[model samples]
Target: MSSSSKIRVIVVDDSALVRSLLAEIINRQPDMQCIGTANDPLVAREMIREMNPDVITLDVEMPRMDGIDFLGRLMRLRPMPVVMISTLTERGAEVTMRALELGAVDFVAKPRVGLASGLNELAAQIVDKIRVAAVAQVRRAPAASAGAIVHPHAGGAAAAAPVAASPLLGRLSTEKLVAIGASTGGTEAIREVLVHLPADAPAIVITQHMPPGFTTSFAARLNSLCQITVKEAVQGERILPGHAYIAPGGRQFALAKSGANYVAVVDDGPPVNRHKPSVEVLFKSVAAHVGRNAVGIMLTGMGADGAAAMREMKDAGSYNYVQDEASCIVFGMPREAIAHGAADEVLPLAQIAPALVARLRGAGDRVHHRI
Candidate 1:
């Protein structure tokens, strides 16, 4: 964060042009410097030994050794933050998710075409991701294996039980909605929260900053791991209990009440706070439509995208929770919500899912009381 301590970065890609352009963008930052570039894993392995960079930008696919394999080895051997540069395709998104599971800090999608022109459009994003990566905590691979990585927020098996009785679980409980917003490190954060939820939890909605072609895979990934169904939001679909809808990337998703039931409304809109599926947009919609019947959650991210709207939700009588700084990969979103007096409670990641269950079960009024 200081001027003297620059964020040392390394760019690893097979393309000469990409390496050069990435180096240029990284060097342009006042607080960052690209110390080295490598065309393949072999070269990167040797360069890493000498440079010892604070962060790495890796291409998703490479000759000889793919990015996923190399990332696994790197995290196992010498844990450090890594940001993946992946193609904008379904395959790329799936691979990027694997990289995250292998300890990647984040990822940026490569332009579909026009390499030079697209890279120019992504200059700010590339630099910002690098800065965030530099500050991220890179955990070493688990002792069991590199593939055994689990999110820090995931709770044990007991978290899967449904609350027997509660104020929100009566005949009127279907009207309740749980709205969640996250970015940066949110994919895993959301997964951690979702996997612990019971199959009968209230309807949940999520907005995680991501590019086109990624949200479907993300939703599928969660659906496979969680007890509840998870799917990408479709316009006009009725919101139902035990299901989680993820906002499609590159579009705005909002909640709209149709008489007694709520439905997802998806539309093309200009980016809000520089994100298409901005957390602010979703939170604002929930505050307006669901009011006190909603529960707002602000999770790990790199920006204050949802802080003001979260406050609006709180002012409308809805209780809200934020992930605490110590458990977050980056504490920007939750920290901002806390600063704005938007959060009712700041909880560790491992406690948030269970706390939500307790609140909906009517026990939260006595336990995990609002600060």
Candidate 2:
């Protein structure tokens, strides 16, 4: 890409130190340039008008006006991609989740203490998120209903009840499981798929790149809107049908079999592909345990984290699908999966859930629907 094609970015944070650090890192990227910096949303508003950058990195907690409120207005009006800078604290996690719901593309967590040391260690992450944001779809978020609203500040747990699992649907010899992975624009993409699943859909396991304290609220938000139960995976819990288990942030979530029943195993492990609760880890586990019985879907994300494991799943006889490039916010992962010859089908975002449903239904015409 040419210099004229470099991604333009703006940094907005209350801390002068943070703003300078972010600008330095962004400017260092060959494909990106920090066009401006702001100490608060007030200044950011004006800078956005002047700079019209491709991406914005906003701090969650800031003086004058918070990032969440600014994000809401920005999405409704200008509709630009944004990556949130947040503290790695309980309160920070709660607010960051709210920002995602407000249409922020992604977020980075900073340490509350040792801000300088922590931010230094996160240089690569900071730049990578900005890069992803630059290409992410920046659409206005749907208005939140009272029922879908989650009061994360009040507590970390989601404010919804789990739906009762429906009796086993098909009579296959082995139980069916659905495993999905996503990053970047995943929060909304996952919601789009989950909302369309029926109450009797097969069990689902998801690994969405998110920080701890945010996954619970994400699951809760889905639980409120979807017909099926959505919750953070708990150690040793049975993977019941009609329920979706989201891999909890900051932990490795894998699947294991307890006799004929599949179960979730949440463990501590080093980050594979530079991510804890990595999509690669989850998909590989599903391949190892569920094999041909599982349905593997890799959605839009910024990297090739799950592509190899998706190949493994295919080798093990599981059906696989990759989100098509045209529908992806960032096509890296899905493109990698397709390149690996892992995908049995490549479908647009609107078609993935229904196609999966059709396959599981044993629709005789599914062969005609393959793209």
Show the lowest summed lDDT stretch of 10 residues, model 1.
Answer: 152-161
Q: Which stretches of candidate 1 lie over 4 Å from their true place?
A: 1-4, 143-149, 152-170, 363-371
Q: When superposed on Cα atoms, how far off is each prediction in RMSD? A: 4.1, 6.0
Model 1 misses residue 161 by how many Å? 9.9
List runs of model 2 lying over 4 Å from the truth.
Answer: 1-5, 140-174, 363-371
Q: Work out how many backbone clashes candidate 1 has.
A: 0
**lDDT (C-alpha, whole model) for all candidates:** 0.86, 0.83
Q: CA lDDT of 271 in candidate 1?
A: 94
Tens digit per residue, CA lDDT, model 2, 119-148: 888999888888788877566554445656
lDDT of 1 by residue, 1-371 (tens): 66359999999999999999999988888889889999999999999999888999999999999989899888878889899999998899899887876678899998978998899889998989988988875667543333343652332122334234334455445877899999977898888788877777789999999988999889988888777899999999999988999999999999999999999999998899989999999999999999998999999898899999999999987899999988787899999999999999999877888898877777334333542
* Backbone N/Cα/C clashes per model: 0, 0
